[model samples]
Target: MPTVRSVTDATFVDQVLLADGLVLVDFWAAWCKPCRAMAPVVEQFAAANRSRITVVKLNVDENRETSETYGITTIPTLRAFRGGREVASIVGALPRKALETRLRGVLGRGAAQGPID
Candidate 1:
């Protein structure tokens, strides 16, 4: 089953920005309650959409350079990137259905469920 991998300032470019397709990066920190609350949902979403997108987590506290570059002042900022550019972003902790709807709106119907990879 697919799982949300961790990305850092050192690996962000290769693992996300330069990745082949869609990549959903969850920017968060250990002290963030909302981030913790949204973890399971992110995990499930990643597993369900494994074949369509790559999911990863970046800890803001540990990855300051990447966080500052992205201007991520909020916890649980979800950014969708493709072709080395960010296409969409969502701030804060949204419910599962809300997250799906928002992502679908930006990503289109192709964001449908896929086999775990």
Candidate 2:
């Protein structure tokens, strides 16, 4: 089973931005209802796309610096990074199809062609 790894301030750069491959980072807070609701969706999405992408969670409460740097005012902000640059972002809880569409666009048809290299 796939799980969202909690990232902290200390490891933010290495875990998210500096990482290779497509990194989907979810910026959220524990107290936020929307964030809580989106957790399962993210996990499921990660499980399905484990070979194509890297999904992670960053707690705004614990990683204030990164949250502020990213200008993440929302409780649940999802960002997709490729080659250390942010390529796309979405806020709020989105349905599975919508999330897949966005990810597919980022990963490209090459992703569906075969398992991630």
Of the candidates shown, which would achieve the greatest TM-score relative to the real structure? 1
lDDT of 1 by residue, 48-106 (tens): 77888899999999999999999999999999987777777889998888888878754
TM-score to true structure, per model: 0.89, 0.87
Encode model 2's per-residue lDDT on 12-53: one tens digit a residue.
789877887888999988899988888888998998888888
- Any residue pairs clashing in model 2, and if so which? none
Model 1: which ten-residue window has the lowest total lDDT? 108-117
User: Which regions in candidate 2 have their CA more than 4 angstroms from the true location?
Assistant: 109-117
Top lDDT model: 1
Which 10-residue span in candidate 2 carries the lowest summed lDDT? 108-117
Cα TM-score of candidate 1? 0.89
